[model samples]
Target: MLNLAKIGHFFLHLWRGVRELSGDDAYVQYLKHHAAFHANAVDVAPALSRKAFFKLWQDSQWKDVRRCC
Candidate 1:
């Protein structure tokens, strides 16, 4: 089981990687929006837990955007 601190660190790293790869604040904002949307959906639907939602979103094609270069 992952601790809260470890989970936080993992997310921080993910955000940093996304920011670095995209090199655009807009993409980061979009990613956050998608994450929030999925989070809310899972909250409202007990059948969909946060972990499962996050995993699904992480592998979702919607989360993939071309790098700005």
Candidate 2:
């Protein structure tokens, strides 16, 4: 049982590390920020959907990078 527990903990950290390195946390962070913004704003805007967030993120990531090799 102890070994099993340790294995589970290891996998959990591995999953988190992979998500962080792969940008999977971007949408989650965005939602957190959006909630905080809305909490402090008098007229809050609706949060973007996941698909919209991913599209915007991808666009912003490559908008200024040159593809020429």
Candidate 3:
């Protein structure tokens, strides 16, 4: 039983590492930042929806020049 629990915890850590490497965890980070920085402001808008956050992220990724001249 202890070994089984260890394996499950290992997989959970591995999955989070993969998400961090692949940028799948960006929204989670964004939400954390928003909660810490903006959640208390009454005039601040709410955090973006998942779909909207991804849309905005994708747009920002391509709206700049990435290569050196």
For model 1, the stretches where C-alpha displacement exceeds 4 angstroms are 25-69
Clash totals, every prediction: 0, 0, 0
Which of the two, 2 or 3, has more TM-score? 2
For 1-69, candidate 3 gives per-residue lDDT tens digits of: 479988999999999999988779989988999999986688988899999999998788887786777
Better of 1 and 2 by lDDT: 2
Can you write out model 2's per-residue Cα lDDT over 1-69, one digit (the tens) per residue?
Answer: 479988999999999999978889989989998998788787777899999999999888887864878
lDDT of 1 at 35: 69
* lDDT tens per residue, model 1, 1-69: 769999999999998888767643444454666667777564453334555655664577366673667
TM-score, each model? 0.33, 0.70, 0.67
lDDT, model 3: 0.90
lDDT of 1: 0.62
Model 2 poorest ten-residue lDDT run: 60-69
Superior by TM-score: candidate 1 or candidate 3: 3
The CA lDDT of each predicted structure is 0.62, 0.89, 0.90
Error of 2 at 68 (Å): 11
Backbone clash tally for model 3? Answer: 0
